[model samples]
Target: MLRLASSFLSVPSSLPHLLALLLALLAPAASAMELGIDRLESRGFDSLKGKRVGLITNQTGVNSAGRRTREILAKAKGVNLAALFTPEHGLDGKELAGKYVANRKDPVTGVTAHSLYGPTRKPTPEMLKGLDVLIYDMQDIGVRSYTYVSTMARCMEAAGECGLEFMVLDRPNPLGGLRVEGPPVEPQWISFVGQLPVPYVHGMTCGELARMLNDRKWMSAQCKLTVVKMQGWERPMVWRDTGLPWVQTSPNIPRADSPAYYVATGIVGSLAGLETGVGGPNPFEICAGKGVNPDSFSNTIKNLGLDGVQVRPYTAGGFSGCRLVIDPKAKGDLCVLALALLVETNRASKPDLFAKSPADKLDIFWKVYGSTTIRDQLRQGTSVQKIAQAWKPGVEKFREERKPYLFY
Candidate 1:
């Protein structure tokens, strides 16, 4: 027994290597992706030493190993995690959009959980008491209209007001950092959804946005902000490429395919022009409603000669609508696909024939879009090519402006 123990202690590193090699040969290739939480845990939570942490996250905050961010924090070496804060969705992320989630106690950690989407959308001074740092870690769907961005901005403002050190555990944009689309929002039209004057698909991660927000002084005060960047990520890689797990960002936007098509479909859905499969199994993946002939619509979009994607008559769950099937591996510009559909749609579409959702439901898609120029251009029958050319300058300027804030 003494000799066996001695052999094990001496070959500790070799034994793990042999085991890993055997497992690698037996199983399929696993992703080598490392998320922000992965780096934080592996490197030891030195930055959080003796600090009472308050996390603003949800079910989406998980490492590549499927460990919850809150659980990782609760068990970290030096972490004094004191509170939990949830954004638009509740702690469990089951609450519907625009619904209020009240403050509750976390059964796992017993920490007080504050609902940022309840009566107030931002954290108040009372919520920050006794917490030394506020940590944010949630996967953003890569759209400006998503409430996560607004929640982050509001928290930044609160951190400034209450003198709290804030840090963000950066996640991949999921939409990647390239491919930006849509018109820059007008200042007056800005709201919680369009927190900043950015294009619809800003193509930025939450960490980059946090840095830009601080540098632009969008926050009330200049709070000490630290963004824990991802180690193995780059600008060109999307979520699927990263090999990280996907949690539904929202009820409608479930898998990666949903967000990839959301910005494009949102252009029509916001105007009450069409229904984009909200209550179905494939939400945000199908566009159908009154006046839509799937076969005709599919042929028209295909005739437009869009690259990297195709249109097809998609029928599922007793509904017949068209889906813009994007090849995940295709390197074509996704932003253009939506524009092509819109342009082709106007040629034969009666915008007046579009159906509208009930008022009680969360129906401010037009407000979420926040671009009168695009809407008016589409309404007046502008060519898709001409409309695409118009927004080139703004997108270029935004890309240049955000360069200094980019980490990966």
Candidate 2:
């Protein structure tokens, strides 16, 4: 327990004041954190006021009071909410992954919502015609390959080219801020999924990433950036500690803690023949294949001595394997868990897991992993421990490089 207050000294002399103080001390401390949108509202939407704003967000962009940021901005006095933009999923987040979402008029605000996942991934000059600023407020899952951050980067480039200001309403990295894992994106593997040079599980908020991209000149052009920082959020605080409600970021990421599981299994899931509970009730929560023995898989994972995660025999979608229960508080590398699963799966059932995977699937795997080297190494019988050890240098370098941009 993190207590909000420790001691109350110099008590009020009056009886009523003293009683009220006692009541205040006796009441349970609130852990409610003010998000970027909440803070912006508290400031009377000053940055957005009198500005023609283009909001890049999805269903996840809501204030502390559960009010949509788009609606708030649309109705805010003197704020003209000119346009809307959505990332991989559509504005409502009902669209499936990798599916193209067509542009449509937002029924509520009547603003034309542009699909950044469709024919045009970046904002066109016509889309930026009358906008003064592009405000991004979507929740990111803290994985480099998730693509929302990539959309943000491209929008920043467009903002720079059009001379429009860019604003990011900061949100918490659900994986917290201390954990950096896996390899940085190699130059050749850079794509929409691996846009930034950050590691797979880079632990920074959207605002921090924006600042770093602009300052580092990672994007082609730099935009005038403004980050409306959150209030009462700490680096160690994960989603559960933030006291904010979880809006499903996408179709499969249906819970607040889903990001941890995604990091644990997303890369491995990219390979064909492995079922990661995508269609079932628990998406990205299970590692199972057609011929896997559940007991052996669970026991092997347990013997690996990975922290912050517990494994058990589980069956889902006619595939038998282990269900991962990750403890966000513990200091475990989720990507390492993915490697462990890959290694164990190869040892137990799929000896040809990598060798037999389809070329397209392998392509996706390498792109998501940020390099083809890891796959090649794994195929050549590299131990999971040694592979994880290899990631230390790059992860450490990123930890130092990201120091200047971290807000919390």
State the weakest 10-residue window (summed lDDT) of model 1.
353-362
Question: Which prediction has the highest TM-score against the true structure?
Answer: 2
Badly placed stretches (over 4 Å) of model 2 are 1-28, 316-318, 349-351
RMSD of each: 6.7, 4.4
Error of model 2, residue 98, in angstroms: 0.6
Q: Provide the global lDDT of candidate 2 against the true structure.
A: 0.89
**TM-score (all chains, Cα) for each model:** 0.87, 0.92
Clashes of each: 0, 0
Model 2 clash pairs are none
Displacement of residue 402 (Cα, Å) in model 1 is 1.2
lDDT (Cα, 0-100) at 29 in candidate 2: 76
Model 2 error, position 111 (Å): 0.4
Candidate 1 regions exceeding 4 Å error are 1-27, 314-321, 342-363
lDDT of all predictions: 0.78, 0.89
